[model samples]
Target: MYLMSKGLWGAIAGDETTSEAKEQQAHAAIVLNLSDSQLMHVIDSATAREAWGRLARFHHSHDMANRLWLKEKFASFKYAASSMSGHVMELEDLVMKMKRANCGPSEEDVCAVLLRSLPASFESLVQAFRMSVASFSFSDLVSKLIAEEVRQNEAARVEDATALYAGKRKGKQYPKKQQVRRAKGPSGTCYNCGKVGHYARDCRSGRGPREQQHDQSNVAFHASEGFASDSWVMDSGASAHMCKDRDAFEEYEEVHHARSISSAKSNVKLNVIGHGTVKLRVWTGHAWIDARLENTLHVQDLSKNLFSLTAAAARGMTVEITRNECVVKRGGTPVATGRKQGFLLYLNADYGTECHMAEDDTELWHRRLGHVSYGTLNATVKDGRIKGATMKTNVACDVCATSKQVRKSFKTSEEDAETRESSRSDVVVCSDVLGPITPASKSGFSYAVTFILMKSRYVTVYPLRKKSDVASAFERFYQDVKTTSGTKIKVLRSDNGGEYRNETMNSFCKAKFIKQEFTVPYNPEQNGMAERMNRTLVEMTRCMLKESGLDKSYWCEALMTAADIRNILPNASNKNSSPHEMVFKKVPRIDHMRVFGAQCYAHVAKEKRKKLDDSGVRCFFLGYEKDQKAYRLLNADDGSIVISRSVTFAEHSVTKASKSRDTQVFDVIEEDESVEASLTDDEDIPAPVTEEELRTPPLRAQNSSHHGPSV
Candidate 1:
């Protein structure tokens, strides 16, 4: 059309002009449009008609060779670039060349060729075109193709804006408007490199392909920078709370469905592997509150953790967004708070050290929760009573196995009652002595007396130096029960041991108006409450000592810890409520509990040390103090007990050297004499002997008694 408008068609159509100047004008116009190679075919021509004919015959001749070459070129045409109009124009030019050579295809064939030449990303659209019964003209196909191309580009831009806005609201930073304007070209900004002159699909430095899908779905990205493992951003537009940290979920269920979240890069889809509840320590302005987010999706490829306000609202949480803050509340209590920065609301939540326990197995919680029964631990977590605890799989705990082993029960005697239920705290207290333990404690104590309240099952254990000291221990326990519960003990039940059957214990019980009940001789099961408690405490002590690599001398500390932990755990006879709760009337908080005998560092006060001295002393965690809000620690260097509120623990570390200890047994040897006359020197004390010694010949009894009261 352009050549005809310029009156240059006359030269190519072989029109003979009478005016020489007009003919030359037409020839010059055609010559100006020809390339150097085309000009070479007509270089020797003397007239416009001759030159036009020579060029036509060489380029688009009606010959078999030219027809086959044009056919092959048209069939092999492929669209690889981003521009749809350019590709269509190239294909149309090939069709026009074929027509000039007298071998052009039909319009329907041209339409088919055009669809086939398009890239694989347009497969869906191409299929729709092919499935149509009505045939399309070449021009109609071109219009539809161009329109679809425009629609796709528009959809991609909208998706990009949607993703950018969503991510910006999730604390993602993008280029400022002024910066974008300065950097972008007349076309637009590239999403890949944030640069000018090209689209993301055409960018050279893109991380991956950014091809648009034919369906034109909206893409959303949580963030564009990188993975934010520790922090969370509040996203209102998100459908679910998405997290990349799988370990952060306290309860999780794997997803079997093919679920995914589209990213800002359209080709990238973040797969959702699971969903679960995440327990967070949400920081309010003044303090931290325990918050659990349910149905949080775990997407391993998510760039940032996102908390969905919509999801939170669905789960009964109230989200209030003001000009500068977002406050989240559940049941009128503030659970989480976020501060607005620019357009985003970033939550002040602590993933905590629990998130760092990615490799932590079930045994870690078993140790941290004070070696509670595995069934109880799992039930607590499953019931949602315990937060920030996960049990992915079971792991064998040798300490628990060895310590919790028990012998089969013997048949109950006819005199023993089937049930002994107490009506109230301190109404009936069960007391029993558990020693002559083989190795004496560091404080030179060899026996422990346990007193358990029959009602609450709350236990108190006191280490004693001698069996006679049981009276003093019971006196101290009596005063404590009176002082704490303001109740008088009505009955004291114990076995027929001399410690409790003696005149001193009888007189103390009579003065307090407490009835003293003794079990039959050799039937310890009659005082089952205290007898069972004694065995429990001993087992706990053994486990803690064995796992901690500490010496048997620390048995007293371990026993005390065991009693403290037992008080907080659910009692079998207490209807699943902890003994502590039964007595104290409040639920005990076990979040502060740590693994027993874990390696720790206790801080030293400034006044207690010199300027050059170390600020902290390495220690071993013993247990908690009953009265004070402090942790009891044993100084590793000096073997001294240190009480401090500020202590850091390394629960994963263990002292390999002290893990094993040879089992030893000792006998309390005594001559026929009074208790006072049995007091002897240190050399007279019997030494611990191995099992092999029992197989050897028995040694003759010595006439001289050698002892300093054997422990």
Candidate 2:
């Protein structure tokens, strides 16, 4: 351009004498820009064109070696500078150099290289741009990347100025989440300014003058804008509150501490940057209200905000957690509520408008009520007999289905039905023996017999040491019934087992004028009432043992408890009243009924214990004592039964104290016919029927002849 302005183009055309002068001027102009190395190559040139060609050949050779070197440098270019604009300028300079060497990459290749060279933080943005429909332009790509880099640096600076508090403050109410410690040394990066050597609290460039007064606690705080979510998860394991949105903070202040916090769902470290009170629109059951979260750390790295139960409790908020929900209250007024989702509990933002607090979950109520049937549960709720208890229909319970599963019942007899109408004159009773249960009872009794009064459906259990003891047990039962009620024994219906059909039982029955009606050989359905009772007691005991986490050895205690419970429960035959009410001629009081195997503390009288001894003994509630108002309690320390009237029960706390030696799964008890009975009865045990089956009208509908005893 300088030669052309000086009218030197005529020098290459050999125009005139004056053109030679122009050539000289043009050559000088070209030479002034070249170095000594380049000037050496072009010194012998006679014209400006020759000198320019020689200089170009010397520096920008188009040979394989020159092209290969330039191509390699361009392909291997990496961004290393702290300034994004400077890095792009360096890349552009390299591209121009490559073009001069005639080996520059295509525009697409350049764009790919630029994106591929960026840090992982820009991966999402790079992917987004790659997926867009817009045309690829190197200049536009560079401009956007530089703009993104500026945004990241600005955000980092702003967050760094905000004080970060990390690590959890130990609290009494809940266990703290594990803090993953970062390795400390010269390699440790300062969390504040992304520098080395000093920690974020000591970094001079972190928060201007505020870094000097950073908190010393080993807490961390970082909130990543890319990962933050709107919903807050309730974390019982967390000891401190955390949030990702800085705008959510009602009051903010800077602090300095560093530690790693992770969610139960993920192990990614959430950086803590600042602490403040975060106000949230919380659904407090009845209304949507602003709940202030005090000392909430701003953690941009967190995917979702965290509401810590431990932190809430420390602030004097009462947190009541059931299986399905967590209710948080201050001064008995609900301030926040969390619904169970998967394994996490999430605070519902629209709970006031959408959430329905109808009833405790039916499954939970099922467990709480000792796995009772939906009918019993509905009745319990409808009668308002149990406070705070409710039932929802159609909710299936796995435990109930598994533990209460029974074989289909046999066809009932036509003339001698299993259930029939009964009166005081009919004084009929059904009897059955259950056991040689494994891991024999605590009292060493391996067998038990139950007597069901035909009319009232009142059940009574007698623990027996052996099969032969059934006869003696029956005599005792008969004597008690005869003395208590002047109703003489009329009909004793039972399976044709040696325990009931033996000579001793026959002689006693003959003397008492009690006709022994045995079921046809192997046809236990004829005596289905007794057969069904055995299965019902066993199933109930199995559920109670499993639910209470008690040992199988306590099956006998559970059996007795089940029988007592069965007596008070409404019978299918007598729709209006329970067996206890029909038999005792008074409404049965269930208010004193506690869960069968609940933890309790029985009071020790001064006379029973020394002055230095503890006044209360930790025990498990067994059942009510038959003769008195006292309760049967098993001493947790000694395994001995304690009868006490003064007992404090904890029904809600079902502990898993089952011993490893005890089988976890309860197998249905199959009658052990192979074992020598010491005597055999000429009868085949029928498949057992569950209590629900007997009560269900479809299977055991009342016969047209008469209604027999309720199973």
Candidate 3:
């Protein structure tokens, strides 16, 4: 038919006398000879000549069916170790097949399909590749895949070695507690219940102690009253050698089925991350002795690391406590010893003065240390920082997604070294403005400025009227620090923001003999103290707001409260010393503290309300008033904020059932396109003052009528 269209009808018929009808018949014969699959590819063609050309070009006589098959194969291809290269080849083959079918994928599409076929373990690698994204090519991708495959094989080898050598030996199996001592009758029949083949175990009438099945329930993590991070405390009370630190284990196994540890009151299902030996170095009166703690329980929701005397005894080691110290001896020779501290014995490790966390185990160690910053563990948790921390960065932890407001402040190796070499506390201060935080704070302040002394990690936050107020805030902060410490500030570090580099700031710094270290144009990382502190404060504000089920207007109270907490949190500079103690030379008084956002009854003075009237007004504990001996409370009844020292708190009454959490309410500011109106006078401010302080209204709530303190 194509020959006939090109006027080759007579020539194609092998005779000049051949008619157009004969040429058409020849074309029809060729079309009919094609397979059904090939016919389908050219089924839409108008003429036999057109059909023949279409079939030859696209599916190569069956291109449509082949294209469909190839597309399905590309979509369904998955990775297999035995044929990873083969899988890649298969994808390439599909590309070629489609190209022949005249419907080939683009270069980018080809690369994407190749990556998509890799196994789950390649997920992080692929994400990392895309994230940094220096270059992307098929060759580069295949090279990376091959390299990853090699690395995985090497890791597998290492893991196998660890399993062979470090893995714990399975213990001897004992008879089940439910197993009956002996069959009741010689015939193996129980007369008690008249059941055959079931003697005493299930016999209800038989006199034997029945073992009760233990039920494991999940427990939420609570802040324990007394617990250390890295160190272990000797305890006769502990049922096992329990450790909360996930990174403490040299090896770990995840728990699938529910398992638990039982207490007199409740049974907490074991999270059972995995277990391995902890290398324990005990300093005796003479020297340091090394002992390995095997079969340790790496469970969650634990505060302190407990070394059980019974577990040690079971492991063929003898524990002797004499002369205010505990000694562990194996085969009558002392292997480990701990000096007594109160009721518990303590053994401080010689982890040395270096980076404690390893490069690879950063995330695991982060989880182990209870999702707090490396330096912020309380009294009971040990500083398990091992030597030779090889500078791992940006390790993400799921537990820390909500909990880590302070974690970001800890400097990386380069930053830490630079900070130490370049700056000193009180001598240099880093200050930055945080926001025009939506739904302006009750004080009508939309922005906050943070001031952090480089030396102590001590912070002071001031509510800002506008960005220009930063200079005045700094003046106040500088004066306060100068008066207290009697040390002149040598430097002021900040970004090249207008607030910091202004004429007022320059004059103040000049008069104070402070060298201003302005970070190059747009880099906030240089003024990390101010930026990180500001971010941490905001995050804490958000978390508290969400937790309290309060509206966003109370960000001021939350920010102020965060500032107070930050001051009291231990600084990395000193051992067991907080910013409060470092600057003020005294432990911050925490006894006066009430739960932030807890429901409380603030005492109403007799002068304000009648004797027969309510003596107390239900309020939300806002925070403590600065330099005052009273709590800032938001009256639930009238929405007025009052300062009162006399308040009764129902801290435990705020249960999960009673509190309705709007999870999505976090980051409450809605995005809008209006030029600056969305930021300044946005609808986020629930404008009209309402009865519930925790409800919508912003600036007007705290200004409402409040009962005066008793005269």
RMSD of each: 33.0, 34.9, 34.0
Model 3 is weakest, by summed lDDT over 10 consecutive residues, at: 681-690
Task: List the lowest-lDDT window of 10 residues for candidate 2.
Answer: 702-711
Candidate 2 Cα errors over 4 Å, as ranges: 1-369, 410-419, 422-426, 608-613, 661-711
Model 1 scores worst on lDDT over the 10 consecutive residues at: 682-691
Between candidates 1 and 2, the one scoring higher on TM-score is 1
Write the residue-wise lDDT of candidate 2 on 207-309 in tens digits.
4432333222221211222111456767543456777655356577755656445432213344566788875677888897767788888765455676766
TM-score of each: 0.47, 0.44, 0.39
For all candidates in order, the CA lDDT equals 0.60, 0.59, 0.53
- What lDDT, from 0 to 1, does candidate 2 have? 0.59
Give the top-scoring candidate (TM-score): 1
Global lDDT for candidate 1? 0.60
* lDDT measured at residue 633 in model 3 versus the true structure, 0 to 100: 87
lDDT of candidate 3 over 9-82, digit per residue (tens): 55333575767676566555555444333556665665455665665577453457777887787677664323
